[model samples]
Target: MLARAINYAQNQRSYMENYLLDGRCSISNNAAERAVKSYVMVNFLFHDTVKGAKASAIVYTLAETAKANGLNIRLYLETVMTKMLDYKNEPDSILEELMPWSEAMQKSCGLNNGTI
Candidate 1:
């Protein structure tokens, strides 16, 4: 059964070309995985208010998203969080700069050289 499934996938390879077009998934769960670290740390260090916890979750989410986008995790988080705190009323376009698929992140990092 497994061999049959593998054979079917191989036969349908062209149909899945778009997903593999860049020769990579262009997505990684690593950021989401790393996000847990900050939450675990904060949960231990500070007593959680609902709002405060929620804020941390958002930061971690963005941080991981930034990481997955190829931005240096440390730098992007620091820069974005600082901006977010100061510019609480910033427009969506500004915040959108931090998205995982943001071109800013893509341009900063070159193409993936990893084996697909």
Candidate 2:
């Protein structure tokens, strides 16, 4: 058992060394674990099929990205959906304006506007 443990540690030594070389490298994945915890719980509670789960994952990711960008989640989603309808037949490049980081979206849906 001790020999197996030592072999495992030796195999992982390079990874540990990399962590030591980077000050910003986390020793554990707790932040990533916490980020996915809600999605896991929501999948169990709300998703009934694989298709539903995939759709939920996309929406959840968009909402999280919007929140991280300081945009009001509800307003940002609403604006994007509404705008998408108008641009559905247009070129995909036009959709860039609908992103949370876009100047127009920031002005309309950003937290600084007291919309949140």
In order, what lDDT does every prediction score? 0.64, 0.86
Clash list (residue pairs), candidate 2? none
Candidate 1 residue spans exceeding 4 A from truth: 1-46, 85-90, 108-116
Candidate 2 C-alpha lDDT tens digits along 78-112: 99888889998999899898888899999999999
Every model's Cα RMSD, please? 9.6, 5.8
For model 2, how many clashes? 0
**Candidate 2 ranges beyond 4 A from true positions:** 1-33
- Tens-digit lDDT track of model 1 for 5-113: 9999999988766656675664454645665876777574684587887887777677656655666666666556566786687677777655557676455432352
Ten contiguous residues minimizing lDDT sum, candidate 2: 38-47
In terms of TM-score, which candidate is strongest? Answer: 2
Error of 2 at 39 (Å): 1.8
